[model samples]
Target: MTYDPTNTPAWKRLLTIETMFKEGNERDRLAREAAATAASFPRVIARYLTDAGKALGDKALAVTVTETGPRDDEGRSAFTVGNCTVCPAATTEFWETAIYGGYESDVRLTVTEAAQGAEQVVRRWAEAHATRCRELPVEG
Candidate 1:
């Protein structure tokens, strides 16, 4: 369906939305590019973490990935990656700050709520599974 934003009374709203649409479209393009760049992070981090674990003789903390959310009101979606649960490695706020650093605009705090949730779930997992620590082979 096509949008009928033309009949709206507020000229500033229309202009602002237009500007936002233009900027958001650009940001979306950049996000896709960033995702392409980000494709290497998991493999790299996993390798590093595994190597570190092996070096320190620490048991590898297995992280499982799953889809977080496509929670959208206006057809926008956000994704997260975590240990089976949806905890983002780096958050929306981090990305926004990284992207729009020089501007004085308000930074939208999407991660505050999601990070809180992730933290709660992580806490629960640690508490519930505290007795089950996997031991690695130790070298003398």
Candidate 2:
């Protein structure tokens, strides 16, 4: 039979279907673009520990970078670099490596006594993870 949609319910149904497909395609495109942008640029977190030249045994330093968008199940934005704790050795000039926990994974560097460039290493790790991680944080 020939399909006709003049003043009929099929017209509305067709319109609805079209709209759904269009919206879905647009959403996919947006997601792709967001992923590309994220891969291209790493998030920036200020270096407070090394920049200030704080002495060893001072207060522990934490460097975190929260995602700007895309909330989690708890309606909170994810942390690309979260819970990064850098503690200075009590009796040594070296700074302890940072332990970082994020939405995607947790990393603990083996370099306990990072004598030089410890802050830079931690910062680079955070920035690198921030660029690649897209998962949202989950409340645990």
lDDT of 2 by residue, 1-140 (tens): 77666657988888899999999999999889777765654344443332212334333343353233222112222233333334321111122222232212255423322212343444566544434433332338
Q: TM-score each candidate.
A: 0.28, 0.31
Q: What is the Cα-based lDDT of residue 69 in candidate 2? A: 28
For model 1, state the Cα shift of residue 54 in Å.
13
How much lDDT does each candidate structure score?
Answer: 0.40, 0.41
Q: Which pairs of residues have clashing backbones in candidate 1?
A: none
Q: What is the lDDT of residue 4 in candidate 1?
A: 71
**Best-matching candidate per lDDT:** 2
User: In model 1, how large is the Cα lDDT of residue 28?
Assistant: 100
lDDT at 53, model 2: 22
